[model samples]
Target chain A: MENTIITIASGKGGTGKTTVASCLAMSARQTVQFLDCDVEEPNAHIFLKPRLTREEAVSLDIPHVDHNKCSFCGRCAEICMFNALAVLADEVLTFPELCHSCGGCWTLCPEKAITTNRREIGLIKSGSAENIHFTQGELQVGTATSPPIIKAMKKTIQKNSLVIIDAPPGTSCPVVETMEGSDFVLLVTEPTAMGLNDLAIALQVVRVLDIPCGVIINRGTDVYSKVETFCRENNLPVLMKIAVDRAIAEAYAMGIPAVEAKPELREDFRKVLNHIKGVTAGERTCCH
Target chain B: MKELVVISGKGGTGKTSIVASFASLLTNKVMVDCDVDAANLHLLLSPKIEERHQFYSLPKAMINREKCNGCGLCEDTCRFEAIKESTVNPLGCEGCAVCSRICPENAIEMVDTVAGEWFKSNTTYGPLVHARLGAAQENSGKLVTMVRSQAAKTAKKLGYDYIITDGPPGIGCPVIASIGGASLSLIITEPSLSGIHDLERTIDLLEFFGVPAMVCVNRWDICPENTEHIKEICRKRKIPFAGKIAYDNMVMLAASRGKSVVEMNSRIIDEIIKVWEKVFEVLCPNMKL
Candidate 1:
């Protein structure tokens, strides 16, 4: 079987993106690579508990100056689009938080005094839990950008396994960066108006990116059928529905995956994985 | 004007639900949705845009093919790898201006792209200033700052007493830009483990900014024990505990109907009211009940 990348994302946070990702990866029969790209607030690690085998510090190159070799020409500061550097009257100051690490400042410095240094913005941890290869990134607090760290994490993807990505919530740069290269996207959502609204926005993103996508309605109940109706109307398949179960909620609060909390649900999650495979395979045939 | 922001460390924890209820309950206020990426406040508020403006602050690299010397210097220097020969992928460009500076032929330029649009709208509540960031675009922090400043300006212009903002989730740049310097922030969280984990980080973030923060555990009934844990943590940290709200299907029904809990008849509405009262008391001490 060819390798497939499935990303679980939600327009709204806390709508079970990480939960679904963890359970799905755990229940899949094939070797799985689970990448938690929500660097800002990664939660899958709490559930996966993969043994850490490697930890890599991700850093961005920021400009440093040699005061003695420098004429305090403000040209470097003027060319910096992110406002990361400013040449003050008496000193040159750099705000590492604002730096995008574009390398424009030191490269353009006429005095040849500016050099670049790698400043840690985040770190990626990789290890394995049985059949599942686990990896996640943690962005340092106060770091503005997450795509670079997300990109770094994606570099460790092994092509031989079924890769499941737990994307950051919201349909923005970080989510887009995570979903870009995926073979399929599973948008997790609740049935609330906010969920439906955000789901539509997320659907637009995937559609624009031309990736085949489906919906997984978490916390399912008959009381809120708006999400289901919207998915049906849009012709997007609803692959799975995890009913709102109190036991599952308790297990989640205790940081346990539903498959473990309710052992019967392992069968349910396996069925969901099979359904995803069938759908993704069908789409590939259609494209060819 | 006193600005109060509603945020959650994790998403879907009822941040918007609380903000929507606050809008229905408060008078003389301006609403701002700082969650520009997946903006849903407009769906509930039904804001009719009175004015709209294009937001063009995020810069993208533009290579002038005519002036290109076919030299790969720009590509070699671009740390973001946005430049490939003469083509620049706008999504990959971080707007570093390194390519423009290193281009020997001066073919590269940093140009502002229309990243998003902001609107001044009239809702039943009051003036609402919100924006929609372009899908797959960077710089949500900039759009958030724009909406917040507009909210402040609208509040000052209309002589409103408050600016209530719905902040995005996580302690990222957008969240930082939203809660900084606010009169107070209401951190809405769930009773899940991730909620507590993220809540701690968000509290630390607010502390770093020295912004006074209050906590409200939404859907507290989902896990009563965890809810208790959350309250205990709040007490230990000396953070004021606003209240806990029980999970009610009616909140979902109200959201489906484009209404706040307070706008409907539900028991959760009473709990939200108490939460609001505590929030206002802490945030607006000078105002009378």
Candidate 2:
């Protein structure tokens, strides 16, 4: 049971990435797993309305310093790669937010004052609605790192389930972690010059991962040719285009994916699914 | 100095476009493009980069080929799976140093990798601080913070009143980095489904941070009906509907010529001038623009 993993990502936001991902989950034949890695501001749940069945803390292994155990020594501070731990003659300080939790500091502590502790960086919640199994992550406000929690969500995927991973915006580590191991990546972008340049960067990220990617031009009617020309030279497929329509906006305000709010989007969603199957299913058969 | 940050919860909703237009309307103002990830404000502002500095991200563990030993321990201890075979990838490595420590053969070394470039530039209007993130680099939030901090120092040193920041799109770290200690934020959005949804979330984020904000609806005519819907949403939230920029081809034409639409002096330019005035009035509630 080789499941098809399709990641809906656009280097730029407000391009209907979530709208497309939630719709694809609804259009799937069997169990579709939806993972929202946009922990910063997740809106897929607002559209899908999934009743979260499980809520668990996503923690990191940070070093907790014990004040009573030892004399303040600078050895642990010198060895920390992240500079999370610092020691003075009188007191030791640990900035938990900066800690990457490599456990190096705790092991290297000369006085053995450093002990492992858990810091809740984010939360991962799982639930189901319709034919979709929904799981999403929420990065705690002010927390710097999010890729680790994204990795945790990626591990929750089951076999034979059509997975739609909604990645966060920007061409960074969080986006990379979500797009990893995906069969097909949908790079959503608008038609503006800014959109084209950002999409180019996003495309390169997927290319480095050695994954076949397709571009879906959001707001296509405004500037389709610029997007088409960029994709043409790069050999990236333009699976579908969603034009700028006001009806789609109204549905979004009331909290629903456009495809569910409008039947017209259903046709576009189907075309994208067909293109995904054609690309990913072919790769799966060849591997088998 | 009133700080007007152009921010949107989601990207590609004309934050830079509106900022460029606002910059064009004003003179003798220092503009900071705080959207460090894919900063294109310089593209429209046509700023000549005067000076550049290298931004270094987290260092990556590298296998010293000369230190020769094909040990499997480095690969097994790597938490990021960055160590595959004997080669270590800079992009995937998390800078944990687990590979360097676990290498029994002492063949691994961690090296600082240049992540991106930040620039101090002079635009036709005034000084501009911008950045370009390196290909496949993380730490965009840090780069954005650097730009704003530099811009603030420059504005104060140069004796400029207003330091306008074109913030990054989305409600995440980069945007948070932009919104810090700002006098006011002007969120540019459209009358659409994702626009309203993201706009409300953006409003919440800004309010949560206690940044007083006003809304400027871009391309409202494209969805005239939703324009009213957007207006109602703003009214319910008590967010001042600053004004609307009707959809116009001149925006793209001006951008193609490396100019802000506000410099074009079109009917749209006049409307944007009105929006800026409203922003000034609300942000300065006591003063008349």
Q: Which candidate tops DockQ? A: 1
> What clash count does candidate 2 reach?
2
* Per-residue lDDT over A133-236 for candidate 2, one digit per residue giving the tens place of the 0 to 100 score: 99999877666688888989998999877889999888877888888899989988877767777888888788778788888887566433777888888878
List where candidate 2 sits over 4 angstroms from the true fold. Answer: A222-224, A283-288, B65-81, B84-87, B101-105, B189-259, B263-271, B282-289
Worst ten in a row by lDDT for model 1 chain B: B93-102
- Over B1-289, each residue of candidate 2 has an lDDT whose tens digit, in order, gives 7688999776667788788877866675789988766777887877888999999876778888888488677776666777777888677787878667667778888788888899999987899999988756878888888888888888888888788899877676678878978999999887766677778878888887898889988878867777798789889989888999887766755654556777776678778889989987887788754
TM-score of chain A, every prediction, order shown: 0.93, 0.94
State iRMS for model 1. 1.5
Candidate 1 local lDDT, residue A90: 65
Docking class of 2: acceptable
Native-referenced DockQ of model 2: 0.31
Tens-place lDDT per residue, model 1, B1-289, is: 7999999878888898889888988899999999999898998899999999998855778988899989898888878777776799887777777777778899988897888899999999889999998777778999999999999999999899899999999888799899889999999998988899999988888888899999999989888889999999999999999998998878877887888778788888888989999999998787775
